[model samples]
Target: MRKLTDFEKQVIEQKGTERPYSGEYYQHDVKGVYCCKKCDAPLYRSESKFNAHCGWPAFDDEISGAVKRNIDADGRRVEIVCAECEGHLGHVFEGEFLTPKNVRHCVNSVSMVFKSALEVVAPVKKTELATFGGGCFWCTEAIFSTLEGVNSVVSGYAGGSATDANYRAVCSGMTSHAEVVHIEFDPDVISYESLLAVFWQSHDPTTLNRQGNDSGPQYRSVVFIHSDKQAESVNAMINTLTKACVWQDPIVTEVAAFDGFYPAEDYHNDYFELNGEQPYCKIVVKPKVDKVKALFAELLKSN
Candidate 1:
């Protein structure tokens, strides 16, 4: 963990607020991730931040499950804190109409440290690829991206016949494509079997072509294996899970040969990271991410 400065200690530990418009990030615009100063848990993304002209830096969203909300001791406003370390993070206000999200997270700049995306993604040594589709790529990507050995997770469409596969074309449910994530990881640090375990636990494979509110062929549960060995491994895991009666419903997750993967547009690469405050991310993605963190705490990156 990084050592916190006195100012950061005051704001994050003592729950003090910075002077209005005085914080460094108030007028700063940078594409990166804002992590908690105390524990380095990712808190917010630069894209969700907006100028609220409220003195302190303002964000319209936070990384899913990164911050927790509680009523103030005074019983008036809501206080936000880092979910991982319980460090103070200022407050949250709703219905302000400050942005399309209609929410504002008034945060003290000292409570966070910014890391550009380039710095966050480390260079890989002999990386391997894994592709999977479990409902929405937004949720799947968010889950796998936090794992210890994962180098990158790109949202994309796979197993489709459509030559021109795009979000709009896939969403129409006629393209036969399922929203998938192309993961690049280091096998030396994390085994493919471990990744397979995460895949089974992260989403319900029994549900045919649906996950939560979003339902279509694009949301199907699938594992696109890159090799024959991968296929055998997936089948073995499925058989074990089935014998264990992990779910009352029969396992329906598809294990198929590898196919071409069409990467989604740039905006979709980090959907949960960028739009976590949005209703879909908040309601659908957050809980699943929290569960993954709890279940796979040993596999997560330290930071």
Candidate 2:
């Protein structure tokens, strides 16, 4: 059992309600399971989540035998609690017709913690890492983040000698770091070779140390392969692209052995998604993102 924070105790133990729409899981949409914050027992599946717009996380159903209902202290509302630990969840309402189920389990986000589907099913679905520097980490991160099997995409710097590298130092072109996106993906769903294809197609690998107007060593086209098998796959793909004359100029993409990666500043993490209305994203990032979505529609996650 996890130690409950003061606020968690207020909600889970004392049966107090959290502020509407203020809970962490109120707007969360990641594919995962939400477990009891007190006992760590699974309580809700992500698929069961819905936008009740009532400021609390709402679900039409609960995991079978996972939740129990009891008369609330007010006697007017029925309260739901974790079946495993009897920790307070929230109220359950019926006959609202929100879904075919006609049921809504209004839940407190603070009473539960989310676990990604990958984490829940890791024993059967192992994940792998792939890192690439196609251009701006912002652009690369956005592109791969939309893929189906991709679990997470992190914007970072790779292929640098410095023990510590920051965006400012790398952008100065003195750090030798290239803006990169570190990807965690389920190889069973999307193979490493499939990711390499996207990396090659997403940017002009032929260009030397530059992508579009973004010029500097920091913007170089590079791959930091984690294994010899990965190295072989990349080399083979490069050879195939060269033979097919995919690009007019010689491919200058640097393929290096996996070293270390330094994550970029927090603000740069989801630049395109968070700041899509910004001028640079509209002019520089959106088109590339759209092009990849169109070209690789089959590989994308279903919305």
Candidate 3:
């Protein structure tokens, strides 16, 4: 079980009441799921939440079998607790007519944690990994992070001879490391070919060892294929693009077998997002992000 603070223990274990309007989620209105703070078991959906004007978070219903009810110590009011861990979750009342359900679950915000719907992807038995280098890692990371099936994007160094690489070493153009974004995605939702299509459109793959004035081997356009299937797919894509005359210049993108990747520094992880106002991000990364959004609106995660 997760450890709880004194205040959380008071409300969740001791059945203590928090002051009205003092909870963090009293006025929260994000579309997502709320889970038990103690056990992480989903207890409510955001759609069931309604404005009760009672200075506490109110939900019209709870996830089936997630919340259990019992008579209060006074034998008058009904108390609700997490069915999994029996943690206190406040009370349930009916006949208020606040909504069609005519029920209100006056829950303590401290008892639950909200997970944004955009962050929750459907469960899959297996997930796939794809890595690519498209000039700046920041640009590729920002673009892929917006895709629905993409589970994660980590900025790193690959295609290098160095046993270990860092931003300073790679930027020096001596490490042979191309800045890359390692992506984990669900192939069932977004195909590898779809990712390649986005990649080809997001950056200039025809320019040799350069992307928008960033000239170095570190910024070279490349793809690291993890399997033979990926190799075949990428080769087919390259042939199709070549026949279609996608670019006036020949594509310089290097197709290489998967190699070890060394993650960049911590601050480099979400560069475009955390440093959007910075001139580099605004000038170099923002345009790629905007291009992906415009060209692949249907593949983006729902807000």
- Candidate 3 matches the true fold with a TM-score of 0.60
- Summing lDDT over every window of 10 consecutive residues in candidate 1, give the lowest-scoring window: 294-303
lDDT by residue (48-144, candidate 2, tens digit) is: 9999889999999899999999999888999999999999999999998888999999999999999998889634668999999998888999899
lDDT assessment of candidate 2: 0.91
Model 3: which ten-residue window has the lowest total lDDT?
Answer: 294-303
TM-score of 1: 0.58
Whole-model lDDT per candidate: 0.90, 0.91, 0.91
Tell me each candidate's TM-score.
0.58, 0.60, 0.60
Model 1 lDDT, residue 121, Cα? 77
